[model samples]
Target chain A: MKFTIQVNEGPYQHQATDSAYLFTKAALEKGHEIFRVFFYHDGVNNGTRLTTPPQDDRNIVKRWSELSAEHDLDLVICVAAAQRRGIVDDGEAERNGKDATNIAPGFRISGLGQLVEGAIQSDRLVVFGD
Target chain B: MSEIKKFMYVNRRAPYGTIYAWESLEVVLIGAAFEQDVSMAFIDDGVYQLTKGQDTTGLEMKNFSPTYSALGDYEVTKIYIEKESLEERGLTLEDLQHLTWEDEDEDWAEKDSIKLVSRAEMAQVFADQDVFFNF
Candidate 1:
């Protein structure tokens, strides 16, 4: 089955991101296809490259990037929500006149239509949110 | 051609103090362009999001309550408010802004969009949906 996962909270402070990651991992391990992982609201914060957790921690954002690299996951952050929360990619930073971009690798900024499309394209649209 | 899927935006948060309500609205508005069969369900504290006299003046927020009225313009005519949720919160149909849509097929006759459903009815609505964007 193809799955599109939505994460609605940021990393660390909320368990939604962790749960989404684990679920995606388990699904991929079971040989199910992950259509996309669309991040919204505070979930956009998970795409900021500046997130630095303690060395002993799980490194949630890095984990997502590595997983995406391994399995070619479509990591999408809502542009409107991301802009409101200061999660900027290089193109967005340049367009918005920001000093720098901090978006983590393997994640892309997109419109909310991406989520809608994911719903239409995927077999299951699973949400892990607060 | 692709089949039109049933999409429901589940609103369960209060209008303010949290960003979920507004963000969910944004998604709905954007999703409207996809031409999918979309509907909205306001339950729990989410019913407060549609109050008629919403005053964000003191809070200094954008006061997006008015935007709900324009949902009909996007052809999103279904707004389901749980009957039990309203009764539990001591609210009635009169407390909310009357949302309506002009049906072009019906010669532009304005029709009510808000549908009051019992909890069981709401459960059936959920089961009918192919995708749910829950807040």
Candidate 2:
């Protein structure tokens, strides 16, 4: 089965990001295809590279980056949502006249259409949020 | 080609207080272009989204309440409002805006777009969905 995961909350504010990550990993371990992981709302915070947790704590952003790299998964952050919350990639930062980009590794900023596309293409669209 | 699927957007939040309600509408508007089988469930505080006489002037917000009426123009006609949600909030179907859509298949007849469903009926609607989006 193919699954598309949507995480709608930020890393630490809610347990949604953690649950989504674990679910994605478990699905991959079960040999299922992860079509995409689309981040919207506060979930776009997960794509920022500037987060620094305690040395002993799990780094949610780093975990997602590593998982995406290992599985070659598509981690999409909604461009509209990202812009509202200042989660910019290099291209977006340059275009928006910002001085820096903070998008985490293995994540790309895209439109909301990607979420709809994920729904159409995947066997299941699991949403984790408030 | 991607296969069409039954997509249900579960809305449980009130508008303006948070960005979830407005952002969810954005997804639904974009999702409409995909031509999927789409439906929206308004439960909990989400039922407040359909209430009439909304004025955001004092709040300095954009007043997105009118957008709900425009949903029909985008072919997003199946809006389900939970019966219990309405009653719990001291509201009824009459407290909501009279939303309607023209059914071309029915000879361009204007039809009510919102459906009032019991909680039990909503459970069955959930069971029928291939995808569930909650925000």
Best by lDDT: 1
Q: For candidate 1 chain B, which ten residues in a row score worst on lDDT? A: B1-10
List, residue by residue over A1-130, the lDDT tens digit for candidate 1: 9999999998998999999999999999999999999999999998988988999998999999999999999999999999998999888999999998999989999999999999999989999987
Expressed as tens digits, the lDDT of each residue in B13-123 for candidate 1 is: 999999999999999999988999999999999999999999999999989999999999999999999999999999999999999999999899999999999999999
Candidate 2 docking class: medium
Using all chains and alpha carbons, the TM-scores for the candidates as numbered come to: 0.98, 0.96
Per-residue lDDT of B23-95 in model 2, one digit per residue for the tens?
A: 9999999889998888999999999988899999999988898899988898888999999999999999999
Q: Report the number of the highest-TM-score candidate.
A: 1
